[model samples]
Target: MRREFAILAILGSLLLAGCSQLERLTLIRPSAQHRGYTQIAPRYDFSGKHGRDTGDAAMLLAAGSMFFQRGQLDEAEEQARKALKAQPGSGDANTLLGLIADARGDAAGAGLLFRSVADAAPANGVYANNYGAWLCANGRAAESLDWFDRAMADPAYPTPVRALANAGDCARKAGQPVRAEASWRAALALDATHPQALAGMAAMAFAQGEYLEARAFVERWLAVAPDEPAALQLAMQVEEKRGDNVAASRYRSRLQAISPGPTTAPRTQ
Candidate 1:
């Protein structure tokens, strides 16, 4: 059961592509809640050669982004590859390819691609943040912390929340509990109910054997996203720790019913 819980956590982190502080905050409010935030109609600018030429590299890149947004991983990858062939070393192309690789479960490939971009453009905060996130997810917590630092140092980085959250996660993985707690607290100050911050807190509590605290964290998470698979699995863990075998079994069955195939395991405590 512990192994299963760990695997589920890892899988949950992987499935959430943009695993940064800002991205986690974005998930706090479902799309329905966005209605209360701000709404804007889609806009397109089409007044260039790239617009006229369907096979143009820029156009292909745009198309790839659209496909990626639509969850067409194969199409997005193919288009991104075509763009890269036309313009080798293009940052946008490389980033798109890396995202496609990540979507297809190739974390190493994605990391390599993003690293290449970071090597080429050391000042690019986007590359730094993305690579740092990949490193953290792949278990290189110490190395990821450096990249997160670089991202934070860049004034042009639009999302400071993401960099801080990622750094905090790396700190937590590196066993710096106090620093991790501080980082998460900072993230919560920016956006209360941030998913990753809440989830990370729960994970930390579980690691420390504070099952009730962990349960409370996950419960709050579920209050916002009741059907979140990770939350459901964590709830099961809490139930098991509380000696509620029947409840735990029910959660396990629900998880199996939702994702029964041979899927990747969750994160470890």
Candidate 2:
């Protein structure tokens, strides 16, 4: 789950630096999966839902993590605080709290909380991945790679593919197309159905002017994540490029159906 948010914000910094290469490339907006957090947040604990204590540190940590993943910062912070009250220096609680700070745009505070966990436990893959994501969001992609590596080094990481996909996304942001391709391929080798990897591969193909191939790749991605507006946009663009006006029009109509409004924003890479 933590792997969903790798640290590597190099490309974003490049944008700040006014890198000209990005002008020719499609910029990829981060997907929910790439943001790497999606868990449910329950506001109240029902009486005797289970034998678990409502305020138990572990329970609080889990609920907090879920809330943080779902982007419910207030609930997550509340749970994390309760967990901390029960057991200070909790890695889980600290991670959730840090994530909440990040969502709220408190980079300094989030960095501090993430550091508390990463510094305390170097071998913790989850913390490493999450910290790396934090570093990237703050425009430190170069420094985030090692943290991603550290996360994958641990066999206990629940989802190594997430780290791999995140690393690929970071590579693209850093303007290393070759590295990005390799990372995406690696992710595919691990899990052929990985949505981000497929979508990334599609983006790579589109960048290279291989419209048909890009279509195929993104079609696979759409199968995995049917609701992603970006994928539909890609499909429309790819069909237009391939001279299939009928299909292109169909995709355009679909896009309009899903997201009603002006369709004027330039598509991202």
Candidate 3:
């Protein structure tokens, strides 16, 4: 059993500058697109011979997902539990329930639930990726890398780049910079403008005293995510390293404007 886990910090936290964005676990029901809810990528089609009530369970899962997206956690949990009752071994229902548990700060329960589904369907890259992210967030960074790799092993996985980017984050956290860089490069190869990959590369270059390369990556990152505080923070660092105090201060001013409260100067690398 794991210890009680800490809740993830909001995006605006100062520590965000040090790590890539963690993809939020979302329910991706196939029917969601037709129902006017925004459809997310990595479409996980949950198919299995659960029971005679499979259609009922699917509808319930879709409803639960809509509720979850709307911030109605209680309603979402109720629907997810009902779906589970209809189809006892439904991976979709279990995944939804895990997401609800995650929202409620029950990380241990969430991890168990996620792991159950991932183990049940080894080929389901979406489930593997979600579980990997959960592991990374719960202080199991080293173990998470294998799950991310498993996700990428599936050719049908729609968002291999997402798993790659996440793998880089967990690898870096696990003190494996070489593995992290490889993962980041793989993600960038798939999607050159990926913000997380760009951010990771920029941070790596800055750390290695490659200010010019870091600046270029920062420019690319900011182009895609102009308001991303971390990119702005890194931009400031790059300019300062290159002896361009004026550019650094400009980025500092921009960052301070968007960030809450009085901002402290970011540390020198």
Candidate 4:
């Protein structure tokens, strides 16, 4: 009886230890519930399976978006092309192709593709927003703002805060600091814990030499995304600028540890 009791106690303790370790692992992992952004791309549901072409262009476009998100640019492009072939004026297909092109560093091609889609479906808030973001990234701030406004005006738009964030980025890049601040504040009003808006505000504050404000925003970002490299780098810069040498050094060490090493030099001729 004594041996049996001892064995049961050991098993119970081992189970409890396993549970504790599992809890710790779950805490450290990124959770979908906490993430504000949608999944990079979602899978498509094609009712007809592999080869049926019953006018399911939307499914093809969605499949392309999923492929693009998974970093399979070639497959994404193929799917997008098939979608376009099935429906010549498919805004979603063109948008997916544009995204794939953009991801593959073909900016000009992406611009052309996005422009065509936006022209075809002027009322599609998603297309307008995506095109606007592309324009903002390409330094066409004025044009981007126009598209953002168009997107925001659409009552059917699901993610207005995202469009507002893009508009804020355009305003910031265009040197309209006051407007940028207002747009970012509006985005925060929509989604108080929006990471992109917070990060943008932090960057603006840092540019103005406001290290404390920048640090606060960066801390918020870290709270949401502890391992984000860009946020980590910015936090280190802020700490260094604020004369927190010890903190800065710690961050620098972390950055060095996480960053990839430089490539070796090639042999001379």
Candidate 5:
């Protein structure tokens, strides 16, 4: 359950290719309510051999991205590798490869690839967010905070709220409740119905034995993410704390319906 609360749930954003004719494209499969991402589309000018190669790589990368979204990992990797071959050091190709590695459970490999891309493109907030999410999900929660900050600092980053919510999750994991709350508050200010922020507030409240506050946050979270297993589990725990057996049972039934296996909530007071 704690793992599900990670900011990595917010996956890859789009990768830009070429310098001309920009349009938005989705590079990763969408998840939950808030994870769809976009980036400038590729329109390479075939003015020279190098330009033609870049255009080919961009086409391969775009095809690879579509394959990835469709869950064809092998095909995706093959296309990404071809893209890399066409455009050596292509950040977009590396991003797709990194995502594929992650989906295949190669966290260390994925981290290295993502880090290389983030380092190569210091001003790219999307890459920064990707690296931060990987770090937090892989147990370096404290170190991940700086990357999220970097993501937010990029004025062109379309979704600062994503970084803020992720920062809140990492802050809490790093045992910085004050920072976590502050980050979550900032995220909620931007998007009032942000599920992760609401979940963080609820967990913090529950841990502090503020059952009423926890319940309020849980209600808000559930209203937005009705089918989320974590939210349902947390709601059950909060209801139990409030001695509302009926409500607890209702939440438990919903959770079990979605996920039969037991899921332990974060430690509470």
Candidate 6:
């Protein structure tokens, strides 16, 4: 289990080419409860001799996104590469490939690819999301905000909740917990059970010495994601803070049994 919580689960957003193909990702392949995604018509204005190729690439990229969500990396890569081969300027294909590069431990290559797509499609919500995420990952969280705003500016952009959650997460990471909570609250108003927003609320409460509030948030999060390690950690800490030695000990023991170490919550994929 990857214990690290991330605001942006990368590869940006995918444009929908067909209804059935896109619905699979929204319903069957959600990464988490807060993982609602949007699939819309291609942002690329395919035209001229390459119009068919660009359209084909869009379709292929959508297929690739499903595979990517399913953790079928090779198949996803094949689809993405085919899309790129069909239309070299396809931002969709580039975002997929860029995420693949990041997963493969080639952050430099991922940065270059994400930057290229972002530069070419400044107004594209998908590229903006991707580039914002890339910037956040590279210690530029402050700068990431502009791109995230750019993404949300597209009225047609689906999943504003995810963008809000990303903003909250980035703000939290940047040591602005109050601002983070405000963003999370906004997300919660839209989606009450959004896991990221709930977890963030729990974290903020915990850091501020509000143990019971943190515990409440933790319980809510666990109801949605029962086996999440970070939630478990939060639970144990809150219990300990509340003077429930037995509950804390039990949670700690459970954490020790399930994870590599009870205390070391290292970020992972």
User: What local lDDT score does residue 180 receive in model 5, on the 0 to 100 scale?
Assistant: 94
Tens digit of per-residue lDDT, candidate 3, span 1-269: 11110112223322122223223221223222222222342233333223224547656666666666567888778777877787677766787787777677677898899899889878777778778988887788899999999989977666788789888878888889999999999999999998878888888888889999999999998998898877888899789889999999899899989986655544322
lDDT of 1 by residue, 70-141 (tens): 678887777777766776766667877876776777777877987997788787665677778777777787
lDDT of 3: 0.71
Please identify which of the two predictions, 1 or 4, would achieve the higher TM-score against the true structure: 4
| Ranking 3 against 6 by lDDT, winner | 3
Give the lDDT of residue 139 in candidate 3: 85
Off by over 4 Å in 4: 1-55, 260-269
Model 6, 13-89: lDDT tens digits are 22122222111011111111112243332342222233334446555665666566556778778878887787677
Worst 10 residues of 5 by lDDT: 1-10
**True-structure lDDT of candidate 1:** 0.64
Off by over 4 Å in 3: 1-55, 265-269
Q: Which wins on lDDT, candidate 1 or candidate 5?
A: 5
lDDT of 6: 0.63
TM-score of 3: 0.80
lDDT of 4 by residue, 2-30 (tens): 00000001111111122222111000000
For model 4 the TM-score comes to 0.73
Mark the regions of model 2 whose C-alpha exceeds 4 Å error after superposition. 1-55, 63-72
Candidate 1, residue 10: the lDDT equals 19
lDDT of each: 0.64, 0.66, 0.71, 0.62, 0.70, 0.63
> Per-residue lDDT for 1-269 in model 2, tens only?
23322222223212212323222111111111323333322344523263134556656665555555455668767777887787677666676676566557677897898778887878767777767766665677667778888878977665667667767777787787887788789889999988778878898899899888899998998898776778888888888889999998887887899899755432545
* Residue 133 local lDDT, model 3: 84
- The order by descending lDDT is 3, 5, 2, 1, 6, 4
Q: Report the lDDT of model 1 for residue 31.
A: 12
